[model samples]
Each structure stands twice: as C-alpha cells, then as structure tokens.
Target: MPSAPSERPLFLDPNLNIIFSVTLLAVLGVSSIAPVFPTVARELGVSPEAVGLLITVFTMPGILLTPFFGILADRFGRKKVLVPALLLFSLAGSSCSLARDFEVLLLLRFLQGVGAASLGSLNATLIGDLFTGRRRTEAMGYNASVLSIGTAVYPSLGGALAALGWYVPFALPIVGLAVAFAVLFRLDSVEVEPGNGLGRYLRDALAGMKNRKVIGLYLVSVMTFIVLYGAYTTFIPLHLSERFGSTAFAIGLIMSVGSLSTAITASGLRYLARHTTSERLITYAFALYGVSFAAIPMLPGHWLVALPVALFGVAQGMNYPVVMSLLAGLAPTEHRAIFMSANGMVLRVGQTLGPLIMAAVFAWGGMARVFHVAAGICIAMFLSLPLLIGRK
Candidate 1:
C-alpha cells in the first residue's frame, strides 16, 4: 500500500519541516511547565497534589473536543481547522504569564487546551496523507524525534526561565505564534474531499472502530499515557525535589536525560522497524517502562536516578511512533483524521486521568509509591496486550 519515496531527501522536504515544527510546538504544553511544578506549589501556597491540576485541566478539553475537530478537518480541510487552532493555542496559552492567581491560570490553561485538542491528531494525520511504507516509518521516527527534542529542551528552558520568576516560563508559549505564522503561510494544504454528509461520515468512521484491533490500540494508548503522565511527567520531578531537595534547574536536567535517550532511540526507529514487528517493539517498550519505573523510586540520589530515566526514554521513544504508524496504516483514507483524532481523544483521557488518579495514589501512599504502583500497571498492561490484541 505504500507509495514510492520522493526525489528530495526527507530533511529537504518543506512539508515535513512544517510538520516537525508542529510536533515541536505541541510538546510545549506539558514538558515546558513540569519542572516548575514544585516551584509553583511553593510560591502559590498550594500542595504539590493541587498543582497536579495544571496538567489535568490542560488535558481535559482534548478529551471532549478532539473528535469534533477531526470531523471538521475531514469536512472543511486540514488548514481550516489547524490555523485557527494554532492561533487560539498561542493567544490563550501565552496569556497565562499574566495570571496572578492559580484559578485564573487554570482557566487560561483550559482555553489553551481547546486550541491544542486537534494539533497532535492533525500532526499524525498529515503524515498519513503524505508518506507510506518505510517512508512513513522514517517520517514518524523523525517527527517523534523532534518531539523528543522539544521535551528534552523545554524542561531545561522552563527550569532556567523559572529562575527568573515563576511566571516567566508561562510566557514561552508565545513562540507558538511564530510557528502558527509559518504553518499558515508556508505549509501547503493537503487535499481533502468533502464527505457525503456528517451523518454518513460518522457512520463510516464508527464502522472502522468496530475492528477489535483498532479498539485494542485505543486501549493500549490509554494505559500508556496513564503510566507516563501519572508516574514520569507528573511526579518524578516532585519525587526528586522532595527527596533530594533538587532545584528546578536540576530537576529539568534529570528529566531531559530521559528525553535525550528517547530522541536517540527514535532516530533509529527505521532500523528497528525492519528487524521486528511494531507489536513486538511496543511489548518490549512496556517491559522497559516497568523496569525503569520500578527502578526510579529505589535509586538513592537525584543524579543517579538518570540511569533509569534513560531506560524509560527508550520505552517512550519506541512506544509512540510505532503505535502511531500502526494506527495510521490501519485507518481508512477517507476517515483518517477522525480516526487519528479518536486516538487523540483517548490519549487525552489517559493524560487527564493519569495525574488525577496518580494524585490520589500520591495522597494515599506518597511520591515513591506512585512509581512502584505505575511499574505494576505497566507490567500488567504488557501482559494483557497479547490477549487484547492478537499477534499480527
């Protein structure tokens, strides 16, 4: 089903440059702010548990809005949905720097989340549009690698900015505006056929979901984020801070270590894809997640903990691109946006619930227990996948 490669090298492809930019900007939502959570909690007079709401509220809107945005993209055209969403994301997200109160900051983050709801799904949708076979895999690997770069840099950038003031990191979303301008003026629109009708489109898309394998992928997506947001992104910084009194800059550096490893693994995904099935790679990813997570809470010091974090990076780098490429391959061309958007919706469900549920775990058992519990969940998921998704 895959098409032949373009004459131009992937790096020279302008369309891909735009997609990579989108991927880079998309990660700014969480990674840029996470290292600052402890600082926020201390400065704003809230418990660390309450600060977790920052992640929760930002992800909540995507759960409800992504499907509709997908439908709109499928109907009107991708740019029609993407440009406005980028504008909204930039305008609302950057405004957070002005908020003095926690409630006000949450409200701003919710609005920014609305803009973000479609970005990830659309980013993947465009890949499905342009490339196929090994080309698509290479593109997915590069896109994910860019995402890894964003994740790796933003925390350190954020932590460094947080040193200036707690609110300074919030101002960084302003860069989204520049990315939005590039997307609007430079990124060529992918052609989209207007569907038969909204009702008919919904029917066909729903029919695609009836496939058990597709459903299994969605379920896998949910569990993957639960462990990621709950254990890695949401709490690990807190764990470092509370246990070792690590500074925001120090926490960011430790967090970036994992992301750096992820970028390295993702850059090599094409070779990995040739050697093994995506399903097997994903299985191995969860295994790495369990091993890394179980080890993190037991490590004796902050800097030493980077060892396990690097292992978790391998899991993350393997998990995201493989799952996305498989999903893109499975989705029908006509309904790909909605199908990918549905993936986005479930991802939000995982992201939203991850911190809230983990917050409960943190409240009950404290920070160290959170990683131990998440480790158990990853192992359970690794075991359960064979049953839910029959071997390809």
Candidate 2:
C-alpha cells in the first residue's frame, strides 16, 4: 500500500519550523512597505525623484553593515544575532509609522535596512548550519519560494492599506514582528566557535574577492539584481504612470501578476534542483532574463508589456535559488555567513547605483531609451554566461 503524504512530518525537526517562520516574517517585514511608497511620498510632499531615495536608503545600510553582521553570526551564533536584529527591525519599522517628514522617515528606513541585513545573513547561515547537500539545496529552495510569496502578497495588501492611509502600510510589519517573536521564543540555538578578529576576517574576505569564480558570481549577482529590480521597482511604475496613466491600485495589480509568477516558479525550484546543476540553471535563467529585458521596451502597451515581465519573473524565480545555492556551496562553512554578507554588499552597490544610472539615462534620453539601455546591459550579462558555464 502507498503511504499517504500527510503521514510524514511537515518539518524534520521543530527547529526547522521555527527557522522557516523567522525567514518568512523577516522577508514580509522588509517587502510589505514597498507598495505604499508612491502614496507615502505624496503625503510627505516629496518629488518622485526624492521618493526614489527610499529604495536607496533601505538598501545602502545593507551594503555597509552586512559583512560585519555575517562575521558576528560566524563568531557567535545565527540565533544570537537574528533575534536581536528582528527586535530592532520591528521597533524601527514601527517608528517609521510615526515619521512626520521625509528626512526622519529616511533615517528610520536606514536603520531598518541595517536590521534587515543582520536578519538575512544570519538566516541563510543558520540554514547552512542545519542542512547538508541535497537537503541544503531543498532548504534554500523552500526559503526562496516563501520569500517570493511575501514579495507578491505584500504589495497588494500594502496598496489596499494605503487606500486607508499611508501609515497603515507601515504598521503591517508589526504583524511580521509578532510572528518573528514566536519563532525566536521556540527555536533552539546552535553553538558556534569564536572567529578570528577583524584583521583575519578582512584577510579571508579579501582572499575570496580575488578568486575569479567568486568574482564572476559577484558580478552576476550585481548585474542580475540591478537589471531586474531596477526595472520593476523604479521604472515600471513611472512607465505606467506616464504612458497609461496608472494609479497606485493599477500599478499594484501589475506588480501582483509578476509576483504571482515568481511565487509559483519558486515553489517548484526544488524539483528543478534534482535535474540541473546550479551553474547551468543560472546560465539559462540569466539568458532568459536578458531576452525579457530586451523585449520590454519593444512592447507597445500594458497588455502587450505584461508578457515580458511575466517571463522575467519566471526567470528570476528559477535563477535566485540556483545562484544562492551555488554561493552557499562555494563558501567554507566557517566563513559562509561572511561570504554571503560580502555578496550582499556587492548586490547593494548594484541596487544603489542601478536607479541612479537609470535616472541619468532617463534624463539623457527618456524612459523608452533608458529601457533600451538597460536591455543592452542585460545582453552584456547574457554574453558573460559562457564564462560562468566554462568555469564549472
């Protein structure tokens, strides 16, 4: 007789359950505020250019602080850093709900970014600590899937809340915080050995930076995120608003479709992991993403435009788990957290600069020209795939 699927335990251990909850909450808290940015900016009396700074402020601190947080996770323990980080994130997020001015909101957002960095680096490191080989890959796949779900669901919910008031969206993180607190209380802590001081950490980080394979992965990470996020988050809203007269609700609907695609694909990544090598999957994913970017500017309107964006979402959903799995496999266990943190730092450089670069291109030409330019950069990234594949 075939055993029923429900007979098996959902998690192998209670700790995995706790960790998964923490990860889900952490992602939800960070992403939920994004959909309300347009509404919030209007209420605060800021220009769209200035409102773009919100994205910058949220990510820049992760660029600067993630490395240190990763090291701390290695030296101490993942849970040790993760719990306190979530607490701060929750508090900082609540504080943002109270801000009366753009400057104050930016400051709070920066601190929120710092807390986000700590939570992200440590969460991944903890998974690496708990799982191995195929199990590790599966864990990462599940994590990616949940993260995509948060990204998809939060925007619509945020938009709905924003209809009430801008501050309503900011308060949503408290729900995430409540979930995080539950996980923190239930999870057992893992013990970690002390790491070398700052000097040794710096030496190891520098050594990783010099490795060609590592450098390639870092470049791909930066470029992929810059192109994907820059287009969807920054330009797409503007494009809809300018060309089709999109409102906050309408933009949220478009974003929701992409997020839905990402969530569905991400959920199936574990099955894909069984058939493909991480390097090969990433190469194919990037190629598709590049093609999608190149197609976007060519589309004439929203109905036609969504096809490319949906393709991009599918490519991204497949790509991230593979990229992250490869990175986790490459780093030494002792330094895994720090290595991930460093990768994040590089990604932030891309995140911080991508919008600014897009803004410049938009100024020089316009949105249509800027999309073409972004497509050009993506094509360059696609051409680099052979370099990535050859190394494997």
Candidate 3:
C-alpha cells in the first residue's frame, strides 16, 4: 500500500527538490532555446528549414549516448555521471551566446546535447530510486508539473531575452553551473549493487526491455516527441513569425500558453489517474493532439491559436507523466537506469526525427500542410494504440 497524501508532502523532501531542480535544467535544454530559433535564423541568415536543424543537431547525440550514460550511472553512481553532464551542458549551452557563426552555433548546440544526453533519464531514475508506489506516482505528477513550469517560463523568458538581443537567451543555461554543484554537494548518492559482471548486467537490462508492454510504451513516447518537436517546438514558432509577423516575445507568450496549460493538467494527474486508466488518459490525449494540430492550420489569427495550443498542452500533460510512471513501474530495480535511459534514447530518436521529418514536409508543402499531415499522423497513432498497447 502507498502512503496517504497527508502523510507525504511531495515537494518538501530535499531529494525531490534536487530531482525537481534537475528536471528544470533538463527542460531548459530545449524550451529556453526554441523561442530564439526565429531570432537566430534571422540574425544568422539561415532559411527557416535550415534553422530547424538547431533542434535536430541538439537532439541527435542523445540517441546514441544516453544508454551508454545510463549504464555508467548503473555501474558507478548517479551524481558522478550527472554532475559532469550538468557542467558540460551548462558550459556548452552558455557558449552559444558568443558564437558568431552558424556552424559554430550548431557545434556548440551538439556539445550541449551531449551534456543533456543523460539528464532526462537520470531525473526519472532518481525518482524511482527515492520513492515507491503511489508516492512515486504523485512525485511523477509533480515532477511533470515542474517540467511544464520550465517549459512555460523559459519560452516567455527566452522571448523577452531575445527582444533585448538574439544571444541573451543562450546565456540562461549558465545557471546550470550552480545546479551542477548543488547536485554534486547536496543530492544524495544512489548506490547500485554491481550485480555479477557487466556482461550479465547488459543481458539482464536488455531482457527487461523486451516485454511487449515496454515496447508499446516506448513507441508512444517516440510518437509523443515526434508531434511535440515536429509541430509545437520546431514549426509553430516559424509559422507565427512568417505568417503573422509576430515578435519573438509574442512567439514566446504563445508557446508559454501551451506549457502553462500542461503544468495545470499535470498537477492534477494524481486525481485523474485514480479515476481513469493510464491507457485511457493517453488515448484521450492523442485525440486532443489530433484536434490541436488540425485546428492550428485553420486558426484565423495567432492570438486565437492559443485555443489549440492549450489543447496541445493538455495532451502533453496527459501523455508524458503517465507513460513515464508506467515505465518506472515496469523497470526492474537493478536495471532501472538503463531501462529509463533506453526510453530516453528512443525519445532522442523522436526528437531528432521530428525536426528532420517535419522540415522535409515543410519543404515539400508549407506550414499548413505540415500541421495537416501532423494531425493525420496523430490520428493514425491513436488508432494504432489498441494494437500497440492493447485494450486494458
């Protein structure tokens, strides 16, 4: 049985506060920079499609490196891996503010991605290590809410920063240096028993990932990022800029609207999970995704676009925490880091593919066609969920 809500005040724990802080940094990886993409493209003299590569190159490293980091965390300790990663992420991410050339910026972003490779997975791993049962679920919801809060604040903040100078927002990640030290000094180290040998550990971890349910959840995670990165993060800002002549501040506010909605929805996930199954909530989230994407292309004005953006936020809030909670539950205690890291690996695949795939579509057609196609893909994924995850 799980502890009562009254007995456990979720955010009051120092360990969870560290987890929340790390989660916020993890979010800053993408959200803080997304609002600045248009400004970067304009200042750098890149095409809209070319600018999308900012997202692509930044996400590409995580696909291959995340699992490797996970294994290291499993064998060694979380802080050993996490602290250095945070420092690297902070330094590389902050240096982007100084890059005058586009290629140099891409290189800096790629390095930042390397630092970010393990953050998403490690945060979840820490949550699993520190909490159990309903407390874990509650923590996941609160953590998701914190992630949403970063997403909400970063864009508007980044946008506002961009209005001052295109490079100002890039300097924000320098705060990670402080966070890195906090993790190094303050976060409790999670010790893992070095079970058997590396070969056996690999075999055991891979075995845990082979289940059909795990595979299904992984697919859902991949699809979720595809839509998130492809439409919301990559193209939506461009659409607003090109079609509406919206300022960077306006773009940030628009993106922040979706994130604020996500924060609100995720904050209530504990109650929602009590009333509905994860699969059902996820399915409903996909329906909202489809509707949101379809409505985006039809919006009469950028201000009115918040309706669809808010809907998309609800879908995101519904999807991420549920999928993660389920994955955390399925993960074997001994191999939890690798299992979650594997999910992170696939998440990077989705993030990498989202921009490239949507950029291709944008090149082939236009913004409206890109979103229409995304809506179709969301509906298709929704229909396939029964086959993927099955009726429960």
Candidate 4:
C-alpha cells in the first residue's frame, strides 16, 4: 500500500530522487556518443564501419560483466559495489575527451560499459529493496519514465555537442559524479548473506532465470526490444531520409516526440495499473506495438510516421515498467540482483540483435519491409501472451 502523501517523510525522498537522476545517465552512457561516431571516425582516419566498434565494445562488456557485478552487489553491500561502479562509469564515459587514439578510446568505452553494468541492475535492485506493491509499481514506472525522458533529450544533445567538438558529447555523463557523491551519503547498505562459492553463484543465478515464471518474462523482454529497436533503429531513419528528405536535426526532432510521449505515459502507468493487471496491460501494449509497426510501412506520407512512432513509444513505455515491476516482485530477495542482471543481459542481447536481424530483412526486402517484419515478430509475441503469463 502507498503511504499517504502527508504521512511520508518527504514529497519525493532526496535519496530516491538521486537514484532516479542517476538512472537517467544509464541511457546517456552509450547513447550520448552515438551521433559523434562519424566525426570520431573522420578525425581518427578510420572506416565508419570500424568506428562502429565503439558501440559494440561498450555494449558487449555489459553483456558479459553485468552478471558478475550482480553477484558482487549481492555478496557485498550496495555502496561497496555501487559507489565504485558509478565513479568508474563517470570517469570512463567522460574520458573520451582525452582519447587521441581510437583504440584507446574503445578501451575506455568498454570499461565504461563494465562500470555501467551496475547502474541499471543495482538501482532497480535498490528500488526492489526499498518499496513493494503499489509503491513498487510506481517506482518502476518512474524509473522507466526517466529513461524515456533521457532517450528524448540525449541523442539530440549529443548531436548538438558533437557539432561543437566530438569530445564535448561525452562530458554530460560526468554529471553522474554528483549523483555518486549524493548516493555515497544517502543510500543505505543491504544485509547480504555469504555466498557459497562460484559454483553456487552461477547455479543460483541460473536457477532464478530458469524458473518457469522468469523465463517467460526474460523472453518477452528480449523480443520486445528486438521488435521495437529493430524497426526504430535500423529502418526509420533511412525511410525518413530517403522518403521525406529529412536532415539529422529533423529526424532527431521527430524521434524525440515519441520519446516524450513515452515518458508521459510511463509516469502515469501507476493509474493505468490500477485499472488493468500488469499481464493485461502488457498484452495490450504488445498488440499496440505490433499494429504500430505494421502501420508504419503503410503510411502514405511523413506526417503519418509521427503517429506510429508515438504509438510505439507509448507501448514501449507501458510494457517496460510492467516488465521491470514483475521481475522485481517475482525474484527472490537473496537472488534478486542476479535475476535483475539477467534481465539486463537479455535486454542488451535484444538491442544488439534488433538491427542485425532487421538489416537482413532490409537486404532481402527494403526499409519499408523492416517494420512489417518487426510487426510480425511483435504480433507473434502478443498472441503468445496467453500462454506465457496469466492474469494478475
């Protein structure tokens, strides 16, 4: 149950506010540098394709290291893992200012991703630790909303900053240091039991993910990202550029509108959840995404594109909080970090796969077909909702 506003200690607790602000930087870490890639490639005399390694190096490490950090967060205290991770994330992300050599910069970006492994998992784990029931749903919704807001703000911010200098784009995440300092003083430590060993650590993590309930949620997360990001990242820009003659700024502006819509819808999900079970909301959200994706390729003009993107964003926002809240609630407290970490890993896998899968579809067909393919994938999952999860 939610505490009455007057009964609560603060309107928005300072410590939790810090946590939410730091959460915004998680999206910033990788995304803030994206628009600068071509500039970095030109400056360093590297192929743009090779420059793409920046994203891969940064993202791949998280896939491998997040689980390790999850176990560490569980074995040690939250601050023990979080403070160092936050500092490292700030330093590694900001150090692009000094990356005279492209290879060295890749190393720094990889380390930054390693550092960021803790931010999303641990932050949400802390939310899990601190809140439950309606409050828990609200916290997850707010966190997802912040991510949507960051998505809206950062890419264009990166483009603007990159115009000034490639190095300037990385500087924003340095704000994370302030949040780290706040967390150091404000967040409380968790009481973790001793870990058995490496074998048990692996087993326990696997067990949590392997549980019938968790597996469905994990698959849903992966597929949702694949379909959403696949169409959004790979084909949307190409379609807009080719079909509508939109420039980088115009494209960014268009995409940000959807992100803004998502942030608004996700923050209000608490009220939506009151009327509909998480399971039902997820089902409807997936269906909405499917229809939106399928409709994009069929849209006759540029103005119609905006409507589909907004629909997709709202669906994504609605789906994400439910996914996070369910995972947090279902996961056992002792093993919750590992479970959350697994979901993070699954998310990255979907993101990585999304473009690749769509690119294959794009080659076989064309840009318009990418959305149709993605729609098929989304619809398949939407139809599976009945089998995968039940009414809450």
- Estimated TM-score per prediction? 0.97, 0.90, 0.97, 0.88
Worst 10 residues of 4 by lDDT: 1-10
Off by over 4 Å in 3: 1-8
Q: Write the per-residue lDDT of candidate 4 for residues 270-330, one digit (tens) a residue.
A: 7887798888888888888888888887878776788888898899888888888999998
lDDT values of the candidates? 0.89, 0.72, 0.90, 0.76
Indicate whether candidate 2 or candidate 4 has the larger TM-score: 2
Instruction: Give the alpha carbon lDDT tens digit for every residue of 236-293 in model 2.
Output: 7677766876666666666767767877787788777678766767777777776776
Q: Which ten residues in a row have the lowest lDDT in candidate 1?
A: 1-10
Better of 1 and 2 by TM-score: 1
Distance (Å) between predicted and true CA of 17, model 4? 0.9
* Candidate 1 per-residue lDDT over residues 1-392, each given as its tens digit: 23347787885678889888888777898999999999889888999889989989989999999999999888888888998888888889899999989999999999999999999999999888877777887888889899998999999999999989988888877778888888888887667778588889899999998888889889989999898888899899999999999999999999999999999999898888788878888888889999999998888889999999999999999989988998999998889999999999999999999999899998899887899899999999889887777656
Q: Which scores better on TM-score, 2 or 3? A: 3
Candidate 3 residue-wise lDDT at 64: 97
Error of 1 at 10 (Å): 0.9
85: Cα error in model 1, Å = 0.7
RMSD of 2: 3.8
lDDT of 3 by residue, 129-174 (tens): 8888888988999999999999999999999888788988888889
Candidate 3: worst-modelled 10 consecutive residues by lDDT: 1-10
As for model 4, its CA RMSD to the true structure in angstroms is 3.1
Sort the candidates on lDDT, descending order.
Answer: 3, 1, 4, 2
